[model samples]
Target: MNWIHSSKRFFNNFQREILAFIHRKNLGKLSPLYDDSKWEPGHWYAEHYQRHFAPLRLKKLKILEIGVGGYDDPKAGGRSLRMWKKYFRNSLIYGIDLVKKKALEENRIKIFQGSQTDESFLRDVLAETGGLDIIIEDGSSSNEAHIKTFKTLFPALNEGGIYAAENIHHSYWPSLSGERWSSLAKGSIFLENWIGCGGSLDLNDPKTLMNMYKRLVDGLNYQDFLRPGYSPSYFDKHIVSIHFYPNLVILYKGNNDKPSNFIENNALRPFVLEKLGVESLEELGLEFSLDNSTPECTHLELSKR
Candidate 1:
């Protein structure tokens, strides 16, 4: 039994080593474009990036990618940084890793060593980069780490820029947090709550990033519920759109300051008048009156008030 167990362990280790070697070797050949060609063995982010970033490729943008692996081996990581540098020829690429990766530094590609959850470190990096046009959160999968990184960096995205969080499926697994249903890391829960899924929320929990998003969404529509003593949300005028994918969430930043307007028509007024026994248009406070003088000449016109 001991020999059998040892053999199994050895086989697993060997397989891991072989796969790592192949990945390292193929990393150099993959291109963000050219979907028909064979892709290097890695996360299938190239196609998504190609679609979203095609417009900004030629712009001189500042991009930050969190989590450069290969922990202690400084010479081993920064594969994504290199890929970004090649893809965005005119852009500067910045990468952050928990371990020191000074060896990966090169022209147009800078590597910073720090934790994704460290707000101060993240701020310093932002200062060094002079603000960011794009941010990709590919760091630790812990719920706290994801939330911290997002809260710290998302606000820093430039107007008309994007923030993408990848590998978000970790939120649904117990190994990353707790139970799938109760876990705060679940991306689905965040999206649901943001879209106004009715439920009570624990606002104090660190895993409650969804609550933040929900509040922002409410802020966007605050004009509808404006009343006495109402406080405004900071993101109410900043967030343009929130997009969700299988294991990803991308946020676009833009001016969302336009107020929503409601255009009421007479299509539904007839139903109310016929079914509820309404006497006159004044009961409904409707400015438009329905005219049925003739079937061919019937029309609804606004009243001069």
Candidate 2:
């Protein structure tokens, strides 16, 4: 068939579903999809997924992404919706968006029309789906939407499943700058209540997130933290960034009592790789370190609720 004609992201088995998701989001927000010309991986969603999705495997995974059915984003392109259907066949896929019936494959893809701020709706979905293996928040770019999802759905993810939100640039949207920690900011509104492992966001004060926001803003700098020239866009607007790039970030869902410490600056950032006698960012072109590998990481951990 035309499988060979597909993009390089597509292989004999894997089809790059996230790329498809990106393109579709781009379409709903921006323009129309013509010839799958909207997205380019190295550019859009690269920093996030490069290390974000490599949780080791995608086979037989269950995935969900909020805020679907939009125009192409400056980063993700069109045909992204359909592309997801192609790549992640082994997995059961579900999506939610402001508008209904617009997600790429409605027949094969389970979709819901809703808002992330709707806790009842979110909890209901999770109840039915059990727990998602990978949950993406590319849905409504609203601050409240983000906060709501963080407060609610993230708790429903499997122990090792990932919960991510994209286009957090809106958190730092210039128009929203002064209003950052205001009642309107999503993280400010919701994340405040999550308890930390040493700090989880679950049992937080709700108002405390603003304080974290202050710390996040303080850390927002293109600092020369590591030995290599790697820096992740964090693709986030709230903080200057998460960790350096060429490496991905892994934030643990520590415990209901305390939040995960990975949210803070990397203690490893200051140690020069040269002095430590390493090559690249850890001598590997990876986004994280040995301690920060899959199941065990110093920066992230859920002690238990």
Candidate 3:
């Protein structure tokens, strides 16, 4: 058994070295997705990131990626950091891993030793880097760590920046579901249901981060609802958009301070009332009458008849 493990390690290291050599030679000429020879292994995100990061390619940017690989091997991590350095060119890449990867630090890439779940450690990293333009959470797939990291670092993202969490399918697996506490449940699961049902969950239970997010998603169309005592969420005011992809969630942070308002266009009211077999707007609790003077008056008159 010991010999088998040793042989496996030897072959893996040999392959890694060969790939690293090929990657170093090609460097900026090839896309990270196309070049499997590169040490970084996120072929799935390459195309997506290329499209999203096109604008920031040449610009000086700060990026933080949680979870450097190599696990127990101190010398084996920082593949993604190196990839980012090559791909972004001018961008500074910062990576944090649970294990020490200080040996992997180079000109534009820095590796910090820390756990993604530690709020204070994350804050320290942010302090050292000042502000971040991109935050990628690829750390421990444990739901608690994912939730804690997002809650801690998302607000710190620069306005108009992006926060992306990968490998979110772990929410469904029993090992990573964080079943011990509801708040620690996979965010992807929460988001799936929240978006599908349009915030039908209880809002009072702050223990579940999903509930909080549900409220924020609700805030997008808050004016349409009748929750009298509910206050607006910071995310509601700042999150420009939430995008969900397979095993991924991207949050776009921006100025979303615009108040949610209803347009007074009643163009569809006549058709809707006719379909419902309703006579007066009073049935719908609306004061305004759909008379002939209304824009859809012909339809309204026809419906009344």
lDDT of each: 0.61, 0.44, 0.62
TM-score of 2: 0.46
RMSD of each: 15.3, 15.3, 13.9
Encode model 2's per-residue lDDT on 112-210: one tens digit a residue: 666667766765666667766677666554445455565466556565566555543344322223344444445431222111102223332233322
List candidate 2 segments past 4 Å from native. Answer: 1-43, 54-58, 71-79, 102-108, 174-305
Model 3 global lDDT (CA atoms, 0 to 1): 0.62
What are the TM-scores, per candidate, against the unseen true structure?
Answer: 0.61, 0.46, 0.63
Candidate 3 colliding pairs: none
Runs in model 3 lying further than 4 Å from the true structure:
1-43, 176-216, 223-225, 263-305
TM-score leader: 3
Candidate 1 lDDT at 82 equals 69
Output the lDDT of residue 69, model 3.
69
lDDT of 1: 0.61
